[model samples]
Target: MDVDNTKPKPDTVTLRWSYSPITYFEGPFRFKENNCCWEFFDGSATATINAKYPVNKSQIKNDLNKRIESIFNASLIYNHTPYKVSEPFMEGYDSKGNLWITPVPINLNLSVSGPNIVIKDSNGNAIEDMKGNRLRDIEEFAKLSIKYSGDPAAQAILRNYKSAVGEPNSEFCHFYAIREVLTTRFWSATKVRSCLNLKKDDWTKLGKLCNEIPVQQGRHQGQKYEQFRKATNVELEEARIIVKTMVKQFFNYLQNSESH
Candidate 1:
């Protein structure tokens, strides 16, 4: 029998990859027509690999495993969590020639995920505004309120800075923000209208908008209200624009209160 020591091994390898928190895949990587490397399924890892190889398959698998482990180790060293989490993650490299990880992407992206927000410029830097130079939800709102209103009290109201049962204190959602701004007391609804010098027609229109929010506990107009439902994106955008206008107007009133 002739021994072939220089030949590459033919091994059945499995890899798993996961990008979403609740979804994953574990199996052989599909063959890419463009690239001729046996791989894991797109965006997944295999639990284990088993196959026959003329060369030492175990050693090759071991080496690959070590490399992957090192990448994760680098992530830890650089404070980058590899797993798909509430925070985003991406691959990177460090000065020590180790593949690292990052909670943010190497490329700047404007992403708004649930409670977290990321707004990067074309150069991948954080947007610097009155919101403390960090990316956050409602940052634009904050900047606008501060720039135009110059009133912290008004900003607080814009932020919906009070908590209620079933309502988040943060004003990230436009619908909730509109409701808070329209309903919260700058003293009282009457006083707010008086202070702003709003005409009765304007006040009635604003009041009607506030009442557009569906009743949380009971049927409205003989229709059941769904707790999970929210205003459509279109409605939210329109409401946001209207509320923004109102906030600016209210701030102006607050600014000239003594004069008025």
Candidate 2:
């Protein structure tokens, strides 16, 4: 419960289950942004299993001791901290004083229940039932305004758009989305950097265009849509067109590249 933020973050955080064949997870981290639960991804493939609950020392040694292997049937392990191992069923410290577990497998068809630590396969539909898999079966709604995952820049753009959707001005949010996508520093910068489609010149030009969109002063400065519009004389429709065009161009580039 008492997370020492001062403690260094782990080099990597991973979740594993008894049946998993691979040890690493890349992410969807569908839980509340950097929280206890994580959704991991690998390239275009994403794993839906989220260790949606936190498990500490007491729960593990107490309730989970007898069912120890079951507890570890689904576990979340962090590389930096040796003192902790969290499982879907329970979390706690073991006598080893270090995480001895190796990565088992990566599976997109798996889903974990937060409170009960139930394992569901791709066939299970209900949250409480463990007979089916939720992640593989359900149609994943676009968390971002537009679900564009072909590359990192597009993903960053869409995620920023999802975050800014409820703001006062949709146009400003769209601008922010464009800025984040083109900035090449948001979520997956490495992929964005290597993207041949979103070149440095393109990034610089987009950033300069967005710069004229003034930001607000003071506390809620990020919510600078009003001032941004007034100062830049940019219209909502224009912003939408820019974003849509970029999205289209990125996908088109991908198609062309793959054909070659």
Candidate number of the best TM-score: 1
**lDDT of each structure?**
0.37, 0.35
Q: Evaluate model 2: give its TM-score.
A: 0.29
Q: Estimate each model's TM-score.
A: 0.31, 0.29
Model 1 regions more than 4 Å off = 1-107, 110-152, 161-185, 199-223, 226-238, 258-260
Give the per-residue lDDT digits (tens) of candidate 2, residues 1-260.
22122211233223332222122221232322112232332211111112222333343334222232211111211110111123332222234333333333443343333221355568875445321233322112222212233356655544444333334244454555655555454355345545534555554544444455454311234555556434243444344445444544554555566668
Residue 254 miss distance in model 1 (angstroms): 3.2
RMSD over all Cα atoms, model 2: 16.5
Q: Going through the candidates in order, what is the number of backbone clashes in each?
A: 9, 20
What lDDT tens digits, residue by residue, belong to model 1 across residues 1-260?
Answer: 12112222234333333332221112122222111132333234323334333335356445444433322222221111223312223232333434433344232222222222346799998765422222222222323343433344564543342221124211223334443554564646676657665555655543443344453311132343554244455543444454445554675665566466
Q: List the residue pairs that clash in candidate 1.
A: 15-45, 15-46, 16-44, 16-45, 16-46, 17-44, 17-45, 29-39, 29-40
